[model samples]
Target chain A: GAGVSQSPSNKVTEKGKDVELRCDPISGHTALYWYRQSLGQGLEFLIYFQGNSAPDKSGLPSDRFSAERTGGSVSTLTIQRTQQEDSAVYLCASSPESNGFPNRGETQYFGPGTRLLVL
Target chain B: GESVGLHLPTLSVQEGDNSIINCAYSNSASDYFIWYKQESGKGPQFIIDIRSNMDKRQGQRVTVLLNKTVKHLSLQIAATQPGDSAVYFCAERGGLDMRFGAGTRLTVKP
Candidate 1:
């Protein structure tokens, strides 16, 4: 079975340009999460989707950040008017359980991540 | 809000020795704590986890201790090996959010 994966392992763009990062969760995973890892913040959860329900976007830093998951399998995080501060690694994770998760707990398997650099 | 801290803290330990990495969390409502390991240029991989209700939980070679009172978490690795060398992070999860602490870099010397 394949684990989580992210496309465009490395990306570079101008500061004002927009960028999108994609994530493919494990098969049958009902819960998907997006996060940003930076030198100042470590790793911060950006948003998460449970099945077709609304995503939890509380962790998103600002209005410039947004994400959408389609068909409950793929997710894309888009940043509008990227800035140098937005240069960081974007990570994706998924689990079988949405709310309760499990007693033993369903570990959120992570992807290798896509490193974004805004010049 | 996200935490502001170091990119990585270095931890050097001799082989067969035990290593403990500590973390301080800001959110007090958090009930679940987890430890993750990240190799060079790799994403974080789950190592162990401990809930707030339990003060300590042990695995084959690792242990996670949570102190809800002070909002702190720690990961202890027994018989640290060269393979254990990596950056370790402690995360607090609750209310659909998981906040990761600044990672600690562990170097196991044979």
Candidate 2:
């Protein structure tokens, strides 16, 4: 079976440029999540989408960060006006659970991640 | 801001030895905790998880112990091997958010 997949394994962009990272969740996975991992840091939650419900963007670091999942499968994370601080790996994960929230204890399968560097 | 954190930044253990990594979380409302392993140039892979109702859970060669009373969590690896070397992170689920610790680098010397 195909695991979660991300596009453009590596990307380098100017600080003020906008960049988009794509994610393809596993088949039949109802819950998809986006996370960021800075150098020498842990994974930071970014956003989550479950079924048709509204996406959770609480973990997004700033207004420059946003994501959208289309047709309940593919997700795109767009960063406006990239900053050096935004240079990190963007990872996507998906679970089979219908509700992607706490207490459910669902196992999330993660993608290889898209490494972005803001110059 | 509330956050999950680990006590140690790194741990070095000999192969065949038991390795334990500890983490501390501040979100008391969290009911589920998970352990993840991340190898270089890879995304985090789920290792195990434990719910608040249970104090401990075991996997093939891993065990997750959750101590709600102390807001602590630990992952123990039995007979650690070189392949087990990676960065380990502990995460706590709060409401709709899941917070991850800074991560502890584990090195297993063969």
Candidate 3:
């Protein structure tokens, strides 16, 4: 039982700088997802990875946002040339193996999240 | 370009009272719905979920109701407690990703 974990609880960086946020899913979780939450806003899907299948990057707002899950456990979300609009709480979540459809009752456990502030 | 949305942005209820949160989604194809509760400085925690096939689902002190015809969803908390005060969000999965609605902040008054 350790839930999902994210590193660098808070990050403040200059605009145009690159930042990398890391996430460690639950021990055996095979699905990892990244989301962004702006001030007073809801969670915005960024990307998702399940096992060895191709990562679903449809949610990525722009090409500057990218993510990778290595060895099927850890995932990193990298933002290149960050913008002030990218400032938000980046949340990571995980769940057990399923048909890739979260609607099927696969509960996603989330981490504390890494707050990013782009100056 | 469908999205999930909440009818109200805030709700206040007395402790031990029943609390109901409402949500509306635009995508008719969405088949799964979930409710999440998030406290300040924390990530969202799964509260309850309901499949489109079912009209209602109950768990613990929480119940989730889905109306496919109206594309509406609601989460009801029975005997609301102080611990239930938080921002609640509803999400719907239609395509490869799920869309989350702007959260509703719940305040439990003692």
Candidate 4:
């Protein structure tokens, strides 16, 4: 659409199960980011993808979290063996810059976010 | 630990009054700063941004000030209204890395 869109606006899964969240960024935005917002907490950076290159996975929180950007357009964040702590709102944002930005990525547009609840 | 914090987690301001939200970031290398507003059930929406090269930037009804000397950032909303009530976040970017602060809940009391 016109802005970033995230899938599974709300997900309820059992502990130890796996879940995948999707994101569709605005057209022509080369930079995409994933973040997690826990209850009564701030947004935590998860991953950053610039175009089709290897994404920055430093913020995945654990090895169970991984993400991939296909064709530099849509992205999916997969969490294996989910835990109660994984319950949070998964947010996605897109910009024209790579984080250290000036060309356009400086102002990122975020999605509505996916609320995940692990039982 | 790298973090961004605020002295007050919540602020109440009267309608039509000016509101100022502050942020203290721990990263000294951070050179770019941004302010975002996130309403309930919504993601953060960009407000304004200032680069390390400059200290201040102004936008529609909003202004962002960056004080590198003390590692502080502030957002000023002119004529604050009920529509401006939301959670405000301060984010910093350095060397291709971006981070967000805890955030401040702004309540515009009408």
The CA lDDT of each predicted structure is 0.83, 0.86, 0.87, 0.86
The sequence of per-residue lDDT tens digits that candidate 4 reaches over residues A1-119 is 58999998999999999999999999988888899988657788888888865446778899999999999899999999999989999999988755454333377899999999999
Assess the local accuracy of residue B33 in candidate 4 as a C-alpha lDDT between 0 and 100: 87
The superposed Cα distance between candidate 3 and the true structure at residue B42, in angstroms, equals 0.6
Candidate 3: tens digits of C-alpha lDDT, residues B14-97: 999999999989899998898999998899999998988999999999999999999999999999999999999898888655
Could you say which candidate leads in TM-score?
4
The parts of candidate 2 lying over 4 Å away from their true place are A99-105, B1-8
Please provide, for model 2 over B1-110, each residue's C-alpha lDDT reduced to its tens digit, 9 standing for 90 to 100. Answer: 12334343889999999999999999899988889999989888999999899999999999999889989999999999999999998888887667778788899998
Per-prediction share of native contacts kept: 0.60, 0.54, 0.56, 0.54
Per-residue C-alpha lDDT of model 4 across residues B1-110, encoded as one tens digit per residue: 12334343888999999999999888889978889999999989988989898988999999988888999999999999999999898888876677788788899998
**All candidates: TM-score of chain A:** 0.89, 0.91, 0.91, 0.91
- The DockQ scores of all candidates, in the order shown, are 0.50, 0.46, 0.46, 0.46
Q: Comparing 1 and 2 by lDDT, which wins?
A: 2
lDDT at position A52, candidate 4? 63
lDDT score at residue A41, model 1, on the 0-100 scale: 51
Candidate 1 chain A worst ten-residue window by lDDT: A97-106
Residue A84 miss distance in model 4 (angstroms):
0.7
User: What 10-residue stretch in candidate 4 chain A is worst by lDDT?
Assistant: A96-105
Task: Report the Cα RMSD per candidate.
Answer: 3.0, 2.9, 2.9, 3.0
Docking quality of model 4: it rates as: acceptable
